[model samples]
Target chain A: MKLTILFGGASFEHEISIVSAITLKEKLAGFDLKFVFCDSDHTFYLIEPAKMKAVTFSKGAYKKMPLLTLAQGSFVQKSMFSKIQHNNIVLNLIHGADGEDGTIAALFDFYSVKYIGPRVDACIFSYDKRYTKYLCEAIGVKYVKYEIIHKNEHCNITIPYPFIVKPASLGSSIGVSVVKDESELDYALDVAFEFDDTLIVEPFLEGVKEYNLAGYYANGTMHYSIVEEPKKEEFLDFEKKYMDFSRSEQVLQADVSEELTLRLKTNFEKVYQGLFEGALIRCDFFVFNNEVLLNEINPIPGSMANYLFEDFTASLEELASSLPHSKRPKVTYDYIHSISQAKGK
Target chain B: MKLTILFGGASFEHEISIVSAITLKEKLAGFDLKFVFCDSDHTFYLIEPAKMKAVTFSKGAYKKMPLLTLAQGSFVQKSMFSKIQHNNIVLNLIHGADGEDGTIAALFDFYSVKYIGPRVDACIFSYDKRYTKYLCEAIGVKYVKYEIIHKNEHCNITIPYPFIVKPASLGSSIGVSVVKDESELDYALDVAFEFDDTLIVEPFLEGVKEYNLAGYYANGTMHYSIVEEPKKEEFLDFEKKYMDFSRSEQVLQADVSEELTLRLKTNFEKVYQGLFEGALIRCDFFVFNNEVLLNEINPIPGSMANYLFEDFTASLEELASSLPHSKRPKVTYDYIHSISQAKGK
Candidate 1:
């Protein structure tokens, strides 16, 4: 099967996607891998997998990677490799914006390409932090108190102090800041506005422990991985970038109480079912005083959430094999189509 | 200016969109018009404007429309026209699903093409009836009482006996049924399920008058068209489709009381600003017992809502000219880029 690994998107988390793609390539070695590198400007580049892997985070090494463009639905390079080839499945590892935010997924759908990820509507639904909060509230899930601030609006801290400010649509905590006091509020708002016109300000959950659960849906049932807790400071400040972020800080099968774990898992499944489809997603939660509050829903998490599941390679192989049968829910307007045709006639 | 009128999308409302494009083409005659016809299969075709207008909704005429495929960044025909050309602007007239639901908007964004419509997040937020209700609830806008019914769940009628069952994401009146009692529940559910996995049941607003307000955003302010009330039966049933629906039944600048008109305009502006950014949108409302309630938000309404405005052609000309300046809010994460680069080094 021809499996295309798509990475490097027009998102702030571009490097993270590249890292995730590298990890996926190594894990899914059994399949024929094709690489599609999406530039920050949204241009498609068909990169050589070996050359893409060899890049050592240096400007010179990046320049040497083979790049190709799409011509008639095929990935094409001008000189030697002049033809384009279609993929049986596109394992999209591109994080944020064009990739995880439904742009690329929609493009794949336009080409009738089978890709492993959530549908366009699902991706767009959860892309905004404000929308996610509304979804959580609708599902009766406990969430932190929040307020949406528009860029043109005056700076009035209606919510209490010591709250975190975030760009509404960004992922991987790119433009996020914890306003410790009134003095830091202005700077935080300024920083947040630089990333998005719409900002979400939520009160900092005191004594909150961050826990993540990765899950996927297959054959009409939801499956989940063991929950992992990331040992971090009270707040994940914007200054503490995600690039240098290490998985070593996470405690696999976290030593949380059984009751709390059960609640987290249950809520995770509920959110996954409500807001997502097709993709393997990671749901982050804040556990405090026996309450599980959903922090974020990562539709395309770092590494496609390969680290969370046990036997990542086996799980991926199973997922890839099931891609042909794992269909996304599509609306069939058979009645409407006929009605429309009759009206046209 | 080079303007491409995109229509006939992969949606239940495909025929309506073609009608809308035909109107747009006639209204905006001053601009250089190019028609990009998107079939139900998502294949794009470049049809001559005169040929497109000549077609009387006939299957033979549609079959003869020039079909084209994308080659790199350009639309290409197989023989005689193999090169690609870019349009200065894309007037997206496609309604529902891949069109109005944000799929094509995201695709246009991916290709850095400026198109007339709301962005992905806003479209998805309003596309889902349940989410739109939540947003209205959050913003303190009065709305009809509704209950969400997920697939695989037992058929439970929580709302009142006289209620409407509708697919959450569909536009127009497709897969929508008015259930007056228990006997009609199963048939309504079956019809609704044919369109989507999730369905919404809302109480049938008794003695409600349907009013619609179409508007667009320009230079940081929302502009409006005349309010029109469609004269229809109590329920806009599936049998009474929108295609055969007549605009002649509508009372232009509806003669509602001044107080009611004020409320409608105010609510319209609030919903427009809160829920949408770009494009001319039509907000549907139900006025019952002096209470104004939001019914639906049509991101890409039929005829581009040309009939609502007093000077339809002038509005199109002005809107088309201002497309370059009428920008959507975007995030600029300057800090994250530098941080990512430094971390990579």
Candidate 2:
């Protein structure tokens, strides 16, 4: 089996994907790995494994190689003879537009290639904050009150002051801002618009502790990890998350009563059943006064969310091996031909 | 400006798309058209213009020509080394999975090509019945009560008898069955499962008149056509819709009240605003006892839904010309490079 790690996409989260890729390579060391790099311009490359350690967006770290593209239902080298066929699975690591938002997955689906993670539709639904909010609302889950703003529409700030403004489809807090007052709304909107045409503004929770659980689907069953609370000053901003070295020091198992745990578990199950059943999802919730408000769901969570699970490498190996691998189903066009022949002279 | 008509697809609606393509060629006769045919097996062909008239699934009607594939960020003819560059817009006519469900459009997006339809994310949401239902629910719209069943889960028949069973993601009623009793449920489930892994079972709306309207986004504004009610013996099944030539006689402009028209317009605006704001959407509604219930939204309707509009050709021309045509934005990797340069030492 040819397992390819696809990382670095056309998104603001490009650098973060590199960090995640480095960690993934270390964790999945037992497997024979092939690497495919998607550049920020959406070009794909089949990288040399010997130079994998030096690959980066930095001036001299990367080397341009033969391009890889899907042509006539087969993945092939651009020079036109070499094919990357034979039982391959893509371990997707692209985080934004072409990655987590379903574009890459959809491309893979178009070619009938197996890619690890959510189906294309699920990724599209989960990546967009507005759609996620709508999904939560439809499932009767409580979420932070938010207003969806389209790019061409005039700014309407119906939600009161001290709200968080975010691009609807970005990950890793790329274009997120905590707006303190009405005066700060336009600036926040501008920042978010740079990332995506759609934006979501939600009333900021003042003193709520953020609890998150990472879960995966294995052999038709959903397995969830123990909840952890990230101790941050406010929200985890981009700088504090990636640049600051002291970020993961205080990720403690969330302290809650058994009744609360039961409620959380039940809600998590409902969410998974309703929306993110096939892929590994990292769900974040705000808990204050025993009320849990669903914040967001990440379809391709960071580091494939390994840290959340005990025996992370072993569990991932099991999940990876269990993927239903097969060649693209040979579509029986016979039915179509039969119908056409019966109808047309 | 070069305009291409992309038709047929790797979907159950492949034949329907061919029919649509023939009609679209007549409807869009004024434009200089390039033709691309997607076979049922998902291979793309750049057919010679003179040979496009013979393109069909009928025995010996279709001819496979130069293979068109996206390479180095542009659509190209693989054998001839010819580039399909310079001011090209795809009038997408693919009706189902690889077409309307966003996979092909996402591929176009990946290559930064312009296509005349909804954006990829919008198409993904609108094509899937389950997601459309969830979006309607989130927006407080009245929809048929439905239960989603995933593959590998225990089959639960919670919806009352005389319900509709449908594959969650297929279009044109490909895998839809109206079950009148419990005995017919298993066969319906089997039929639905053959199409998709996810299924939606909804309580059937009895004694309801089905009204449909075609609309599109033009010049940043949504344009809607008058509602047309199809006089069907029962629900419009796949055979009656396509195989029966007498299907077009009974489509009448709905004899609705002024108040009903206003309500329909309002609801249509809300639905478009809340969900689809990109391409043309054909909305189906059930009207009975002065109540309106959304049935489903078709992202890529047949003949691009020209018959529903008053000045069909004029309206379609306007919408096509008003598409937001721009090159794919060049991504700036300077920030990523700067971060890598600072940290990767």
Candidate 3:
């Protein structure tokens, strides 16, 4: 099957996206594949009949392609996608559009392509912090109180000093800052503006413990995940999360009361299904003073959070087979079938 | 200041975008304008300043530009945007991306560009249905029972049959459908998916009438506006509300009791400040059984719903000027200046 995996958006999380894409491809090796990727530096690659072999583009000069920027000039018209072989399903493996949000997914809709991910509305909702927070509240899940700092406007920074300032749409803590005082608010806003325009300023949880939950949905059945207490040094940001060696620690599970774990599972599923398509989501939350506060839902998690599911022993193969393969046969009989069905045929 | 008016996205409302861009241009004649547009097709256009001619390449097009096929090597990248004149605000004249949603505004944050719209979180919450309904419920506002259809799942369309389906992320009545029978559910979903993947299905309200309240925020003050009754053939769809001749039956100053109207206005302003930051929003609701069920909020209404102020005989110029234009320039300078100061420039 000629299924294509789109990854590595124009986000700060580009390199990690590469890791995620490669891992996803390896897991899906049983199917014929096409590797679609782009990087932060803007280098892009598409692997036809994707494999471990090295690929080079060298007609005149050697260079790679970037996915976000399609070809310029002549072919940049409406008919561009019309000629491409659409797969049975498109699995979005990238994040941070820095939450480029729903553009790629929307493009899939524009092409009438069948894709496996949250719909554009869900993607849009999942991408923005403010909306995600409300969805959590709607479903009776706990989340922190967040005040929005509008673009080009003063935030009043009055939500008590020691607050967290970060880009609302970004994940992986790309443009996150802990503002301890009035002096730091300006710097926090400046750094955050680098990643996203809108900022969510929420009171810092005094003693926060972070946990991650992963869910997979296949044909209307939801598999609530075991929550993992991330084993990390301090708080990890972009470099710490992706640069591998920089990570002081990483953990797949933590021991907790069965009831609390079940609650986490229930909360994660409620937030996932209550707000978006019951597909796959990596729901993150924080526990402060024994109260769980929703952080956000990642519609498409990095590397599909391959590390998170190890505790359940759900091998990549098992997970891959559980969901329908998006790959398609190189040759299609649709056109011929249509022709034969015609009156004159 | 060298500024761009980024408009015309790959949305069902693309044509109305053209009108919005042209109108913005007609009003922004005094500014140094750079026209950035997403065409009727997939092409992104950079209208040259000299003759207002469409240019083949854009600054950041390099990242966005790629050869149609990987076999066709060394795809030219439209990577010009990295060098756009510094400190320019993008007059995001586009809608559905909602302009106010964090993504485009986050672009402003990335480039330090000033923009006009509701705050990012406000935009996020306002445009989302699940959250909007929750906020309404939180504040004692009435709404209909709704269920979210997770992406591509089967349901007994019978329960919600006689239901209205709408795209979550999209504003305006585009990609909306009413299903009266079980057989129509799939067709309704097929149409709803055209605009967005997330479909919001609610029991269609068949009570009384439809009303829109034009709201604005200036000097941190929320202002109530006259309630407008949309004179249309049906609930707002792109063709019904945005088409060139769709306003032939435009209704203004919808006749209702003063006491009821005053209560709506008071409650609307309260909800607006608490749930949204209004650059401007068109609040739509259904008047059924002597009760008002707040339907949703359009943070970025088509043409900014300028027609709502028709009774005041306010010229487009007067209404447009009332918007935060001058404040934007100062806000732009403040952010840049703050960044410079933080950088020890």
Candidate 4:
């Protein structure tokens, strides 16, 4: 089976997606890899593995590649009398809006393209910060108290001072702000509203221990990765997060009590089961007051969060083989035929 | 501007979508109309307006038409060096899974195609019955009390006998059952689970007054349709709902108290305010104990719910013109370029 890396989208995290794609080319060297780049203009191009470099995309040279169009279950390069089809299972590597935000998932599902990524509903739950809160509430998981504030409405800071504000539907800390007091609220709101129409505000807890766990469910069992406490100062802003995607080395696992680890794994399992089928995902949690609170869900994590798992390649293969297949109902058009015959049309 | 009617999908409601497409061809007769048919295999075809008949599709004649492919912002028929591009704004007329379940919305959005339909987030909220409950809870709207039951889990009828069992993610009455007694519970679960993995069970309210209202937000204001009290004996099953989509004549407005109408409109507004911005949607409500309880949200109503509005064509035109445009973020990739330069790659 061939693996197609689909990366780059019309998103704020487009560059980071490129970095992730290039990194994957090295990590998945053993596999028969095919590279497909979605430009910022949303055009699909078939890029050669040799040309899968950061500068190739940064210099806008990838456009000269063969243009690809999506058809039922395949990507095709159209010719005069026929088309060349690349019937490879796609690895959705695009991040942020078009990748993590149900766009790519929907597109693939509609076209019947087999892909290894978060399904549409999973993306809906994880992509939006507000929806994540609702997801937590539904699953009986704990999350930080946050209030949704839509743009063009009266802005009210009900979450108290020294809080964190983030655009509800964005990733990679693009439009996130740490507001200290009333003086910084307006500027932060302005920055966030530029990225999204709605915002999620939560209390900025100082000295909170944050842990990251990535996993996927396959072969009738849930496979988990070692939980790593992400090292950071205050928070990793957009630039720092962008740089972090380039790291390929495995990080040290977090040293925590077995009970706390079990709690984190349990919460992660609750979020992953049923909702996040067919994809590997990372959940960041904050241990506040001896309770695990979900911070965010990375549906399509950076570099697929390969460093977290001991055998990333083997895990991906298992996930790909055991991806949930949508049951196709028999569409005989029997009802329509009866209706037409009854009407004598 | 040219108007393209995209109908039929890999959904149970595919035939109904064809009926809706043919209905729209007549409804928007004054406009320059084009017909695009998505077969049950998820293949797109360009059908001539003259062949937009029920028999043409039921006989599988649409497969012989010109095959189309989707690209950036347009549908095209590719040749050796040039392609015929149909850069028309699309009217998403497909119903049920692939249509209303965020699939087509994400496809169109990712391709930058201009369309008049519910966006991705709106589809997510309205597509699944369980998610609809969460949406109502977030907005403080009243919905019927229910519990979700997964197919693999123990079949526990916690909602009592004489309840309604529905596939959580399916539209129409495809996999729905009205369980009147304990004996009917297993059969209902079996039927619903065949269509979807999860089921939402709610108390079957007898003699409930159900009202239907269709509307859209356009030109900085909300335009409502005449509230319709559908004439039904018990509930619309699959076959009854199937024939109902073929009705093109205007439905009569319900004769109710002005106070009741105001309450319905207010609740409808609350549901549609921010979530559903561009598309015309219909919300079914049950007036139980003088309170309006949301029954279901039809994101892409059949035949665009033309019978409810006085001037459906004019309303669609206004909505098409005033559709919310996604703000494209500037992708400078300046950060990536700086890092590359520093690393001397």
- Determine which window of 10 residues in candidate 4 chain B has minimal summed lDDT: B326-335
**Per-candidate fnat, comma-separated:** 0.30, 0.40, 0.06, 0.73
- Candidate 2 Cα misplacement greater than 4 A, ranges: A53-55, A60-63, A71-75, A78-87, A151-158, A244-263, A274-278, A324-344, B49-56, B60-63, B72-74, B80-87, B150-159, B243-252, B274-278, B325-344
Which clashing pairs does model 2 show? none
Candidate 3 C-alpha error for residue B256, in Å: 6.1
Q: Pick the candidate with the highest DockQ.
A: 4
lDDT of all the models against the reference? 0.72, 0.72, 0.58, 0.89
Per-residue lDDT of model 2, residues B90-176, tens digit only: 878888868878788788888877677767777866788877777777676677778988888998878788999999988888889
Which candidate leads the pack in TM-score? 4
**Candidate 4 interface CA RMSD, Å:** 1.4
- Considering DockQ, which of the candidate structures 1 and 4 is the better prediction for this target? 4
What lDDT tens digits, residue by residue, belong to model 1 across residues A1-345? 467888877676677676677767776677788887776655566667776652433233444555665433445565664554654477778777777778877777666667788778668657777777877887788887788889888866688877999999888777788888988988888888877889998888777888989887766677788888775876555445354222312237888788887898889777877557567888889887777889888888777777678776666655665543322334244444576577693
Q: lDDT tens digits, residues A1-345, model 2?
A: 356788878777776666667676776677677778888667777766665653344543554676776644345664456456423677888776678777887787777776677767778778888887777777778888888888888888798878888988787887899999878878888888987788888888778878888777677677777787766677678855554321222245678777876677777777776455446778888886778888888777777777677766666655676655422323344544556568693
Q: DockQ (Cα-based) per candidate?
A: 0.38, 0.45, 0.09, 0.72
For model 3, residues A176-276, the per-residue Cα lDDT tens digits are 98888888777889999876667999887776888888787655567755578876555576556654312212344677788878878878767765445
RMSD of each: 4.0, 3.5, 11.3, 1.9
Ranking by DockQ: 4, 2, 1, 3
Regarding lDDT, does 1 or 3 come out ahead?
Answer: 1
